[model samples]
Target: MPERLTILVVDDDQDFLGDFEVIGRDFFELHTADSGEKALEMLKEEEPDAVVLDLRLGSGIDGLETLKRIRETWPDLPVIMVTEHADVDTAVKAMKQGAFHYMSKHPNIKTLHAIIQKELGSVRWKNLCLEEIRKQYGEMIGRSAPMKEIYRLIARVATVPLNVLVLGESGTGKELVAREIHARSGRAGHPFVAINCAAIPPALFESEVFGHERGAFTHAVSRKTGKIEMADKGTLFLDEINSLDPDLQAKLLRVLDDKAITRVGGNEVKRVDVRVICASNQDLEKSVAEGSFREDLFHRVNGIQIVVPPLRERAEDIPELTRYFSRRIQMKTGRAGPVFSGEAIEALQTYHWPGNVRELMNVVERASVMAAGREVTVQDLKLASRSGKSQGFFQELLFLPYKEARQKLFSRFKSVYLSELIQRNQGNISKAARQAGISRPGLYRMMENTDE
Candidate 1:
């Protein structure tokens, strides 16, 4: 049996609330709140699939404020606003504040039930697709929308024998996506050869890609097989494809078209069945326009283009990625891994990861190894922002609720100010209190409260 969906109804009308209980009993598991304060409390406890809120409450904060607060914490949850006396201005305001839908109280309960069902239907389908991707792609550690779309694209393009071009910054896992496509395709059992175009010298580029006969050049002591030949009946991934020399690009285009390669200094042609997948951190289109990369080769290798999102764009996945790296470290070292504090994770999410996922993995591994105890704090991560300031102080507050964040900011300010004042007074509380324009006892109390 399918699990029943849950909804929270917030209103002050006792009689209408009772009627809704009977009306929605068959379709949903219901929770009721009489005021906005109670509704926010219930939101944290119940975590319902959707919320039905009244525009006006008899006491405390009204529906609009409640909706704004709900959006702050749970931005993706569906919220439908229903009022007994809905005005055009009020409905527009609620919609602007992120209400899923605004509806006036109607005589029939079926209309309200239908709206909820329609909203949740899409949410359920997305979640189901995400679950399937999770089961299949275990190496990709993200559930964000961008990652989900990439998973769907990979699934669609895996079976088709077409060239793929992956575009992303360095360390964004472009090669990982190519490998995933190869793993899911018919070429899974064959070799998945990879070569870095930028790492090879221009002189050896031809010999490295296509086999050369014995004595083809000074270094060619014997007949050698190249990456393309080694990856026969499989996938060949060329990283930094934009760095390939223009002369070699034309030759590669010819091989891709003919599905064959001719050995250097030899007449025999070799027929090979290889699917080519290329990746470039640089802009290949701009490179082609600049007369560096061949436009013909560009189109040949770019049958399908997949762009891997950078790590900074998917900050929500940092905690999961952190846990994954920690687990791997534990397995490798045969010891308990360091557990990251909540603040540490928040600091990580706020960082501008210019190096992308590979950089994140390195940071996690380093922090785990250097941690003095099992618990790793923000200081252990040692993150610095682009401005060269520590990320633990101000940037982390972006992830917290407004009230809590304000309080933390004030507390941090107090700690810094009071410590400086006391140090300037040479540890004399009386002199520090005089300078701060407060009584000595009051200064002592402030120090006690802000300690650590």
Candidate 2:
């Protein structure tokens, strides 16, 4: 049988907690905290899978304060801010503060269940090494061979503070990888702030990185902190760092050289202690050789390089990844559809995936929404297959070591069988359970075991 999820609901009102318990009992092994202080204490004893926090807790620490404290201590904990005082500002603030989602005091039970499912999507990687990735990037959702290797590399690197340069195509989630690195390293508890060098205008580059005084510029009315200063005592991810101009590159070199920054229009040099993780899609070496990027700066940030392989290379991971994307889309849209057929999976595996994982995500999302029925067909994938393209069966085997190779084949068989079971019963859980000679709970357990 599937193990029950443990959930803690914190509210000042005793009656509300009672209602939550009644509604959520079947879905979770419920725990209640009447106060934020008591919730924190209980959390220390054992962390809950999810938290339902009321915005206005009586006295001591209010919901916002408690949320801040939780983010400081356990940043990964999923929190749903429940409140009657629902305003646009409060909702935005709660989300920015890292509450999983915001809900009204009296939410539908179905909505609550949907929220739980969404929150659980992010709860993973308890392994310290992988936990670092989860803590930083939220979740790394791909069971593909390439992604598995990336996860393995993350595990290996999380313990060391190496200046990692993640190389990948533009939309391939390099920042996500950088966050994983920071989360896994000794700096996991600290901030993993990102600054896109290409996004900042040349006029504001220095001010963006090093901040400025109140009167630094004509329109500057107040003292503003820079990205680097904000990332002090934490990990600073320079996304598309190759786009940084030579002058700013020199300034960056100085910062790395002296571990300090001189704010725009400021005479005093302020010390900053931070771990730098730079990412780029450009040919950084060629750029350095061509005088567009600094060679010395390249040396500084290239201590450890991780090349994120393109999605096409790891096409075997398509099915599980498709399911993952499907689940997320389902949660987001509050409507589940476009379950992939075998031919559809094959079509996805055959695609070039020129845009890589990000592209695949978009395609899957669109296909799910557009498909007439719940089942996604090969045509839904929109990949033009070559008339005589090799099945690449042998190529799939080459990506894995012997143990993993065996496991993959076994897993594939299990997945195919499970799909057939569900299809044969027309998605009737109890009938399928009876046909498979397993209890209802056991069926759910098996479903969880397989990524299907």
Candidate 3:
């Protein structure tokens, strides 16, 4: 069997610690520490993903003292504190210290399981990505310019363990970038936890991030572990990080600085070791300046910034991207794919795609689905209207002499008038006349003269 994550359970009660061991033995290699001194000794060799510590550990150097030392030596360790009934004040104080979470006596086993899994899962993900890359790619993909730049940056700073900020538009594959960095870094095979800040609601953000003890508050049906604890000794990818609230931002900064986190509703300082990689569509700098985000947090996260260029900025990659999409679409749809006509390619090249590669992929996928013949036509391209005019808006003018620009404009208006009339009447002319703000005879005369 694979080597499981090491977990330390520290409590004065040997019976309670033994129970925890039985519950977690299947998933982790359990270690028990009865006192603060013992816990510190265990920590030196086994940097655990989680530490279950009791608030009252006999008499000398209590759980709180052990937590402080843990935070001092390994600030990024995830710790969970156990408390007695009505120990809310102490719990709150433990939270202020850096406990990832806290739970009361007779805590829910299911909640404990969930918290352990969340943290353990993050570790598994980081390991899988790095191990897969080393075993398959030998090195990360480097043919693409954006990829090469990222590789260079990772190689330079992977050993230092500073925060990395990855900026890109949605669908630009920022998560992949984060993975590549972790794979190349010294912490490869450790946890790689990813969470999208914008995807989670603000109301549940705290519980989603720092976790909550069972019955921490209303609807706190079970205990939950946030991504931070899951990513101990690994990398944490904070996608759409700009959406984090200002208050949460401050809390996150505190964690980054002290390497600790306090779970919601429970108090105990948990130490965690994590490298944060934050990605955002928004300009965090501007947000910081406007007081919508924390500047200190921004600096901490933005230690090394990598901006992923939009697909349009790298126009040279269109053919490659298009071809790749085409092949994938063909495989998925099992369609006899239409070849892009020369004119169709030219039209695509001229287009100023506002939606970037994601849009391009959609266009190709749709075209593949709608192909009726062996070739995709200019008409099939369905380019956005030029200046909001309907189909043939530019084509009609393109054929006209250069000097007839004004005359072409007039022709366009006449076409618009007829189209509008048809639409207003539901394809009936008599009703369209009144709706056109014109007389029936006048409308007929206009239609006759403008007939294509």
Candidate 4:
């Protein structure tokens, strides 16, 4: 497929927009805005490869003001200015304000295309250099292949502090990933505020995030700082971000774009400087497609995507993780550290950790209390080794290593389960994922690997 590079044309001329749409249809995807204010809004959504702007706008904000905001927010963006014969001087002013090039109202379409191509070429090289600088492993623990890949991605995206959308299963330490990024960043000294979006009540969500003035409400007797305000000069980690109230989703996006927030029941807009990193167990793209999540807000937060693989894929790290968590827990509790037997470690590795690292930590802590003589044996490590109800599989599981038997029996079970599920939902992966309480991508992976 030809690359669908987007080009945004900002002008009040309906005829001109229609002309470009027809002209650029073959080579690119075209988006249009009638006013400067709308253009900026569209820019956030469309994220065009390049912009064709009119020097003189109709109303709200003129081209100059729009250009200024774009330059401030997305400085490297290339914007070509178009003007009428009477507005040539204004076009020159637009150039001085960081316009890529200025042209007549009826500029040659070929020249405009060439300018867009040139800008795209420059943007690619700029992003390439940025990617090279962003590749470094932080304090994340894990030497597994999958984990090394995650570290690579973390380093790749850490250079410029772009808004990130972290995706992982529950108990996969999403917050730790956020903290690692912040710790390696320039804002390490600043507060790293985090809130589970699902934990906040819907009625108090707004006040909790944006604060409330003293006596602003019936219960508000004291002034309090909001998460956005507290996270200024730092990072805000929103866990289970898909659970944010629909009403607050739009409000959050506006704050992110404006870099300012007005407290609930207050009129003053306080400027904030915070990098937002959000995590979701749910598939946000599916949520957006289902209309439960705002598509615009999704795009705003997904500047960089990092998907943390589930522990089952990185079982090689279990023993190391076990030892690390053990030492840390021992230091905190001053208890005798339990020695994990080779059998115990193999038991942990063999089990499919549905709850991932967090679950493993809980098991290790429990084993510390349950162990006899500071030695964690196979009996002490009561790991869950069952996948699904396959006749004779549980008895057979006891005899064979989990990984060896997983292919033949579990594949059958998963294939039957997913086949029934997909059929029940009429082949809708999103609905099947929700019904099975797993991520859509995970469900798809199972279906791809299964043979039933």
Candidate 5:
């Protein structure tokens, strides 16, 4: 059976809260709090699917202030604000504050119930769609918030024929994202060509991307088709696109604008229908600002931009990723896969992965081959010590109680790990926060608490 959705209702009126017992019993599990203060406390304990907050609390903070705090922590949680006396000004304020819906409390409880049901149903459908994407795209893994948002964006842009720019650190599977988009797009039947812009030599770069006529240049014995032509009616993914030569960037821009390409040493302009997807590890905006990249070409390819979070940001998916890698190794060797101990998994999660998913796969494969037994212990996974302090840092937590250990681990990790992260980004909090997959304000708060 499916699990029941939980709803947290905050109201000062005990009589009004009691009405939910009869109305929501069949549809959801309901939890009630009398005032805004109690509601905030309940949020820490109960992971509610939706919140029904009263606009005017009899005591404590008002609903708007409570909603503001809730948005800071749980930005995606659905909130429905209901007031006894609804006004246009109040409703506008609630909506602007990120409330899912604003409504006046009517005598009939069914209206509110219907709204909650509809919202929950939409959430469930979205989750199911994400799960389907996960099952279909084997190469693209992770169900973390960042990955889920990427999946949603992929689904939204798959049908639309627009150039896309994928930005992420190396080994974050930018190519996999491009492939998934092509596989789900309208041009699935056609070719999906890929070229690493950084790998090709400067001399051969133009010939590789745009085909050459016979005897056009050295080693051009016969007329050749370029990546764009090969991917006609399909997708052309340019990996490490920031490395493209300035001259080629202009040529590429012209092809995108005209939907045609001219072969080297040939006057014929070939018309091709190809969707372009560009991936870059470096900041193309900075390159454009420094005059190293063309601003016009950047705009041409950046119709839609998608940023893939690094592995450290989605550490919750580490264990599953480890399992998947272990299974692949087992298939190749025809042996049983290794089972990771809880401590080993936790150790993996604590490490700051600079190389992202590719690095994790390498670590898992190495550990699987080196493990003495079927169960992989923490020692089997020889994780590199970051700054020579991680070994002692994690060892210190082993003696504490589970709750205390968790708190201490998080606190220390925020101080040490986040500090190093910010430093690595050269004190740019926005860049560090993006790599860490948290809001800038959230990072500031964590850093401030660490200082305290």
Candidate 6:
């Protein structure tokens, strides 16, 4: 895509790292992360094209765990795992986990160069294709058949002032559709007020929907206009219509039927000329069947119904959705956000996304924060889930690059560990040495080497 692809080589083996960097410098913009944590931080700072990840990262998140997070965040980015864990089991695990290629430690420079180029060569064109797709979908970002049908319905209903009911799961962007319809309607010049029916308490719901008098209640100190009054000449979006209380539901039905609303604790009725748009994640028909929701109110509001497809049902839209969210993140947060790697988008499509578009956006936002100096890796995505917790020791490390992977297991061999342990003891080399089961002079020697 660019003149030279960026390659991040992460290995704690100093000699091997030096050799690899020397070999890679000519062919790529080289970056290095000795630990998985630094590698991840680098990824957020700037997204590299590919990573030469050693299977053994001594501390923070292990190599495999880091790879997993990278896939979660940047599924499309290629990761080439290099390790002395040359066993077939390890190779198979790495391959199944989506590593682009796997090689034993100390790979031939020529071979490594070829693999890196091959993995990254097509990325530029792929990115161009994605950009084209993003431009094609102006606002509604989906190409699935269900969405196509929904578009037709939107066009048909936009001009009419019919009461519209939007049905879908939570986070399916029902509110977006309502806004689109209002924007296209004749009342576009007027206000488009929205209220979440389920969010308001039952006691306050009526007063919220209908204007309230100054002395209507203890808290009612002055005349207050409600959502219905606010949308007098425009559209009133009542979200979560099923959450409206039975009594409030009846009052709302009267307003729709009579085109007027009487303020709370007032005798005079004020007329209104407004269109109503209702949205609900709960199935109003089922609620009506159970007698928990009023049938008359449902009939009054259900002049026309629009069903928004869940994200999983329309997976084709995710590419554009991710791009949309990325652009929005830049505008909203005022920062350059991470681009979705091809691997990352595929992983997102693979997910069931029970929380729908909302969850996907949340994952993207979090990934942007963790993109590092390189692109988001799979590891970032896995960590984005609020419930994500490390499943440590899931697999045996017998195939690990024992010398490097086990470095953290042996504290005396680790300079970073020595420095941190010394600091933890408030720079008291004696206590640190005692706790580390090492002589004071041994700690001093380690510190001297660390300084060197």
Q: Which model scores highest in lDDT?
A: 1
Q: By summed lDDT, which 10 consecutive residues of candidate 6 come out lowest?
A: 385-394
CA deviation > 4 Å runs, candidate 1: 1-135, 385-452
Per residue, candidate 3 scores C-alpha lDDT tens digits across 1-452 of 43465678888887887777777676677888878888876675557778888888896798887887677545557788887643778888888888878898567766765786686676578668756645643423323676557667667766776899988776565676788778778788898888867655577778877899999999999989987998999999998888888887888888899999889988888999899999998798999889998889999999888887766566655554565577678899775576565456556666766555556776777776676775667677676543344456677667879879667777767865575447324466665665456787998888888833
lDDT of 1 by residue, 85-195 (tens): 978999999999989899875435566667777888877887787667656785787988899889899999999989999999987888889999999999999999988
Candidate 5 C-alpha lDDT tens digits along 1-452: 23456889888988888876776576668899988878866775555988989999998899998887677445567899988999999899999998989977643455666776687788788779767866767578888999889989999998998899999998798999999999999999999998877656666777878889999987889999898899999999998889888988888889999999988989999999999999999999999999999999999999999999999899988877887798899899897655666567888898887767877887788788889975577788767533244566578678889999899767756765775566445577876776577888998988888841
TM-scores for candidates 1 onward, in order: 0.58, 0.55, 0.53, 0.56, 0.58, 0.58
Candidate 3, run of 10 with poorest lDDT: 134-143
Query: Which ranges in model 2 have alpha carbons more than 4 Å from their true place?
Result: 1-138, 143-145, 383-452
Q: Cα-based RMSD of the predictions, in order?
A: 16.3, 23.2, 29.7, 26.6, 15.4, 17.4
Write one digit per residue (lDDT tens) for candidate 6, span 1-452: 22566888888888888887776666777888898878877886777888889998777777787787677566678898999767888888988888988998878766776777776666667777666644433366776898888878887898986999999998788888898888778998999998866545577777878979999989899998988999989999988888777877888888899999999989888999999999999899999999999999989889999999999899988876786787787898897877666577778887777668877887787687777744655677763332212233213334567785475335433644674465445467776776577888997887786621
For model 4, what is the error of residue 284's alpha carbon versus the real structure, in angstroms, after optimal superposition?
Answer: 0.7
User: Which residues of candidate 6, in runs, are more than 4 Å off?
Assistant: 1-139, 383-452
How well does candidate 2 match the true structure in TM-score terms? 0.55
Give the lDDT of residue 111 in candidate 3.
72
Against the reference, the lDDT scores of all candidates come to 0.83, 0.77, 0.74, 0.78, 0.82, 0.78
Off-target runs (Cα >4 Å) in candidate 3 are 1-148, 385-452
What TM-score does candidate 3 reach?
0.53
- Ordered by TM-score, highest first, the candidates read 1, 6, 5, 4, 2, 3
* Clash count in backbone of candidate 5: 0
